[model samples]
Target chain A: MIKPWLRIALAGNANVGKSVIFNQLTSLNQIVGNWPGKTVERAEGTLFFKGYTIRIIDLPGIYSLSTFSMDEIVSRDYIAVEKPDIIINVVDASALERNLYFTLQLLELGASIVIDLNQIDFAAKKGIRIDVEKLSEALGVPVVPTVAITGSGINELLSTVITVTSGERKLKPLKVRYGKEIEKRVQAIEKLISTKLPQLCTVYPARWVAIKLLERDTDVAGKLKNYKNGKEILDYAEKLATELEKIHGEPSPVVIASERYGLANKIAKEVTAIEAPPRISLEQKLDAITTHKILGYPILTVAVVSMFALIFVGGNFLSAGLEFLFENLSMFIEWGLSTFLPRIVVDLINNGILAGVVAGITIALPYIVPFYIILALLEDSGYLPRAAFLMDNLMHKIGLHGKAFIPLMLGYGCSVPAALAAG
Target chain B: MQSGSRGSSKRRNPRGIKGVISLISLREGEKGVMAYAVGGFGLVRRLAEMGLTPSVEVKLLRKGPFHGPVQIEVRGVGLALGYDVASKVFVRPLKAKLDD
Candidate 1:
């Protein structure tokens, strides 16, 4: 008898086209549901290969598994507890240095991973040359080049996934070593947490939790509040933090982040190659005007006004055409009703519900669809971040930080999702 | 009272015209003469930092919206303040030509 389905996870940063790759792998065969406890959406799809069904899960986009954000917490929980058979880390080739920061954190989780170097086409056009073989060897994971949007190298990626999932390909672990003091503190905290909360064993690494506690992460402390002797555990952790801070002359989070960055830089230097600096291209010029300190706001205002103007002009014309079509359709429907039914029934069918519903759909389509399309385009183009940066000072004065500006700007498009995002 | 300081002139306007400096001018710390408030609770910290205590002298340059949301040049910088807060800031308007 064939074994059960092998579970695979697709993880990456936002805008890395993880969704596109997920769609490609499992075209129409997918299920969307919330994860067991969290409200975050989870998607699962099946791919049958070599007589075994593989279950693929698309996890939320997270910058790191360090648990600073809610998304990271959810992602870390899933990977640590669920223990998926393989993790396909889809990394953007153009921004490999930043992407590798998360890659190193994921490696420390000690899970099996395959790195998907996505957006090769765009990277190449920008003159970015990647050494995939060297990167794979350095990271100790199979690195596959892919243009997920165009479906290039996806087959190879799938085959590699299959191979890794099947245990035919073994990956050597990437060990990240911190300073002696941190390692010692990590070991102490890991022992305490493991002994105190064995039930949480599947959910979080004791060492990771210890590091977060040492950093004075309130979120983690709150989460572990129910554990036996939680207050004592926290006190001990705080004592350790005080000692470490005295030695390091900085907060624990800063020290740990510095160490992570140092490791990432070292690995990046070994695995990646940077060519001579390229000349400023068209995109850079556009970025300059678009993100200019002085010119950016005016340009943004004009662009927004132009978009509204187009929407108004196009909407009027489209509404007239839609009215004509709907009028003709209404006439056809009336004729059909009159011919097929008695007078009373025909009158009821024509006047009661169908007419109102059709009119509603017609009215909603033009405004709702166009507005949604425009908002989606703005989000996909990554213009929202620039808008946030431009309006940061104004937002900062209003008691909301600059980071909150993105959701507020997006709120202009749709309040529901924007509020959700802000929350 | 004698005006003894160099290049100093003293003139008084109608009573009860004061405002807080919202922004410091681009220039180095020059004593702000007038200011305004832009709404939001966060400005409390900024006002504290800028030494904008009550009973400070302020002159209103421009008022917007229902004769409110006034913009006053304070410490060489322009500040827009709301009407509710501006009413509380009492000022003695400068009678001399302080613009130079």
Candidate 2:
């Protein structure tokens, strides 16, 4: 059977194993960084599955579809504009309420999606039990429980994806409705958009554009600027927003956000039950010490010092080992070539091209590989946030947040991911 | 006590309801319910997107030393907010009634 190429974007909150799932599905060497916003840009990989080619896009972790951050804008534009065939809404099951907040926003955009309920093991450990069938019914989307790191439930996730894409499984997504007050204005703006700006409606769901207008999203507002009667719609949106502000006594955006959170909280409460009392795990205990007011700084100092020291000692050892191997290989190659070619030619080939390649591998890979491994370990173990929590105030002295330390430390190993992190 | 700290009335209790204080004012381990953020629309939306919307329970899990960011737990998620950002998110502390 012939199948057309399908594009699926994996999106959710930061550090919720989207990249891990991306790696699982596409077998791509995506940096599975632990920190939020680690995947600054969208990473794409293709998988040939059961005769169908699927394009998987791993979007940066975002809390909401709001245009406050670069990651949000990139992910939002890609989903709304590019219109991927299926969006894998990867929710961290451990933090269902918070993760669902983003999931709700994606639903509002009217994109076809399946909830990759990633990190179910973590939730179970935390004593949180989710009714998967109920959650799927509530959201009106297929919910697949997955442990991306262990490659569990990944095959089921793919089969479900193919079924949904093939139209074998029909989805009736529940529309995200807000409070009556907000809903009234949303309908008014949505009608105005559909009738006046039909072209914009094609690009974005009319209702989504209307809701964004109600939130006074500058990005959505900017998109409307190109169309005729755009100014009139903006004025109408602004006027309605002011009226909403009057009733809520807060900004329009906040009011809309509160409503979205309200919905997310409701769904989370409905589908999740506490099966067991949460026990303080070793991870929490470690977090306590590493982020302790007094002890944290000392631990951080030792961690930082030891990381660099290991890199130095390990890199040197590996470098020497590789250099020795290359030296022997170079001698063998030169001897074999000199028997046939001129001595000068053999020397040039051995000393120039081969030597350059060997030197790069021996010097760079030895240091870079160790640095990345240690960095990944620090991130994967969830120690980086604790380190950031400790350094927050001191980092303020330099006019950067404590989170800035991650990129600064990353700069030592390589400047590229560090620069991306900083951005 | 409130008189000395009074500045922009708009930034003050946005709803004119008393007994709310900045989230940063809570000591480590203290709990509060989110009230409202006082900064621009961007900050309020950003905080809410992180699940810090009004009426949600929050606990100050840790405070960085030397006037740094405050780590707060909301909706079972831990978030570190810089001093400037945390100060704008006013919350009604659970201890306020006891103190009063």
Candidate 3:
């Protein structure tokens, strides 16, 4: 009997430890690069489990499926076109409401999903006890609580994936219900699309297409224009959207997004019991200070400067030791070659091969590896977002968000290391 | 720009959120429940995705001294909404009965 292949995608919001879970599952041989012409990075890796080869892709971290950003576009296209066997939404248990908002979108897409509730320990510390079974039942999917850093609940997540993919377990993901005003329009557009343009559903969920139409998502809206009856669908969508706007006293997308959040919040409140007031922890206090208006700038400057100083100082020391060791190694190789070969061969050994290897090992690797580690450490400790939060106003002035700061700074150094560190 | 939208009709006049006051009116550390994110669809979606839904309580964490962008805490996450974006959202003060 031949083993079948299973394709999985790790989807989540940023800082939910999606990358950590990806690293734990795939381990090595991961290919990392940008999504052709786009600056945002793409990561893919492969592994074998239970005699089945599994290909895992770490999609870009995005807050929503709306095409407001490149990350959202790339992720949605992949899910719609490629259609992976299972999508694992690695959510921060502590931030259920926000994380669940994204999960609600995935469910709307009708994806075969397994929820990996990462960072459950932190949530527990916050006096949040999530009833895993109840959450699973509510979302109508398997819910696996995991501390990705510790590799807990990973096996259960894997097994659940197999069951869901192999048809042993059936999943009926909960679909979010928008209020009557929006729902009525969704039904009308859904009917039009099905009757006139059924092929659209082949690419995207029919109702999802209607919702996107109502929300005036440019990417989806632009694509629909090319199809027959697309004009009618768009016009109807626009009219319905306008009515929705008037009814809610907001835009159509806002109404849709709020409805989604309403569902997420309701679900979160139901499945989790807050045993204590989620008070500000020490980390939260420090996080606040790091982004404080009066003190944040100085702290940010000192933190970045200190980080680079440590990297330079530590890299210098490591490089010095490595340089000393490799120099002797190259000398020994040259001597060994000189005893048996001509001068030219010894020169080649000394200047050509040994030089290249020594330069890479003793110089580049020493600095790049440690610097990348420290940068990742800062990012993982949740400092980057805080720094971004503090510098948001400044970045906003430049027509960018605070999240752009890290990438902008990374460009000053080698772009490769920056991509490795940030991507 | 005035925080409230000119196009959309008000569903219900919020009692908690000042009737006409926008998010800019809130002081630091003042917490209130969101009434509406009044703006274009794109802008509203951006804020809603950050958990700034109607009736959801939020805290004004900080803002730069020079009338800069504001940082807010919503759904246990801290975010910095630009001045333009911040002003578009309206909020009512959190009431004791709506603590949940």
Candidate 4:
């Protein structure tokens, strides 16, 4: 008997090791594609573990469910509409408060979530200690602390997923409850949505829809406008939001965002304790010099020059080695196959396909490999952002922002990924 | 386009205007409490979602060398805001030393 495929999604903020976890679970079994009609890349991979085939989708990393960008909209729609069986929320343990702000939104969306507290070691180094059990209890979901790079706690995470999805263990995620002012309006809109447009409830939780409407989310508003009663609900939502604006003296979206942040801050404080006041670490020291007003420019120049210099030298050595090895292999193949096959066939097999492949690898792989490894190192080590910070002023003069420098720099190595990243 | 010195020097009556200065005006190591961000709904909402709500304390960690982005600490998170965006986020300095 074949077990049904278990669907899981890895969701999180940018740079929280979600991709690392995705790569860990899926290993070589992965396919990269685009989300239909959207330029956003979608990665799907499968893992077979413990008599189960699990399909994992890595959603685009985004900060909130708000439709600020195409990524946020795609993630939110996938969670609410597609409805994955389990969502592995990879949150940075070092930055729990800000990360939890996104978690709160996920909970609000009513997704079945397991919090992957990634980079726990980084948090520990910063003298931050988290009560994992307390956090699990607070969120009312299983919390797995993991260091994705080292593969620690990954097995336990899988086991937890099995236990939760297999019906042995149950998840009772905590519902986010806003303050009195916002909660009352949320309930009012939720009630109106349930009564007026019950069909919308089938696709989304009434409460979630109500909250989105209150936030003046254009996506939901557009969807609502299609329904006959949606106009009435939209008007009511606008009036209620205006009332909230009157009370808060800010836009409804800002009001709701502030309230959500307040709750995230509260939960983060409750579950985490700082063992020591922040002392300057080596990263901080490096950050200081690398981003210094006067020294930063010269250092950035040196760093860029050294990177290219290393890549060129390393690629040349590797290409020469591979070329030598492949030359002998091609000769052997030609000689070995000539005895059994025609000269033309041997030539086709050896010189045509094999030589072509060998040439491509020797020419392309050597350079691409070193360039990517160095790029990954720069990104993972958090130096790339600083480099961008240092180049911001210079980059702005060329009609671009600081972040534009990354793809521009990537252009020196390869135009394909650089163009994709620039988009 | 007000520089730090120029912005601070143009003193307004404390009772009338209250000393809420643009976030970029705070030099490195200076601390301020976030007032409200002034921008279109998109910008304000985006900043608020990143935990830059009113009353949260922010410290100017560093500024890009030449009128670039401003790196600030808000709610225990460090965020880099562009010059134009940073200028819209008004904050009240914790200490009133600009006058002295």
Q: Taking the candidates in order, what DockQ does each have? A: 0.02, 0.70, 0.44, 0.74
Candidate 4 error regions (>4 Å): A311-377, A403-423, B6-17, B96-100
- lDDT (Cα, 0-100) at A224 in candidate 1: 81
For candidate 1, the per-residue lDDT at A404 reads: 72
Rank ordering of all candidates by DockQ, starting from the highest: 4, 2, 3, 1
Tens digits of per-residue lDDT, candidate 4, A1-423, equal 888899999999998999999999999899999999999999999999999999999999988889999999999999999999999999999999999999998999999889999999999998899999999999999999999999998999998998888888888888999989999999999999999999989989999999999999999999999999999999999999999999998889999998888889889999999998768888899999988889988988887888878777898999999999999999998889998999999989887999999988998788778877887888878888888898887898998867687678768876755676687
Give the worst 10-residue stretch by lDDT in candidate 2 chain A: A29-38
lDDT of 2 by residue, A144-254 (tens): 999999999999999999999999998999899999999999999999989998988888999999999999999999989998889999999999999999998888888
- Candidate 3 C-alpha error for residue B87, in Å: 3.5
- DockQ-superior candidate, 1 or 2: 2
TM-score of chain B of each: 0.43, 0.79, 0.73, 0.82
Query: Please, what is the TM-score per model?
Result: 0.71, 0.85, 0.81, 0.87
Question: What does candidate 1's lDDT look like per residue over A1-423, in tens digits?
Answer: 876688889998776789999998888899999877777888999988767788899999865665555667778767887899889999988767557767877877767899999998877766678899998988889999999999999989989988887789988857777888888887788798889877765676677778778867777798788876688779989998888879865456655655665666566667656565567798667755665657877977875765565554565567678878877876788898788678888667767666786666555455455655665676777675555556555665688754576456556654654575577
Per-residue lDDT for B6-80 in model 4, tens only? 355543322234777878878788899988888799999999988899888898888887787899988777899
Name every residue pair that clashes in candidate 4: none
Off by over 4 Å in 1: A1-3, A191-206, A217-234, A293-298, A332-342, A380-423, B1-100
Looking at every candidate separately, what fraction of the true A–B Cα contacts under 8 Å does it contain? 0.00, 0.86, 0.61, 0.80
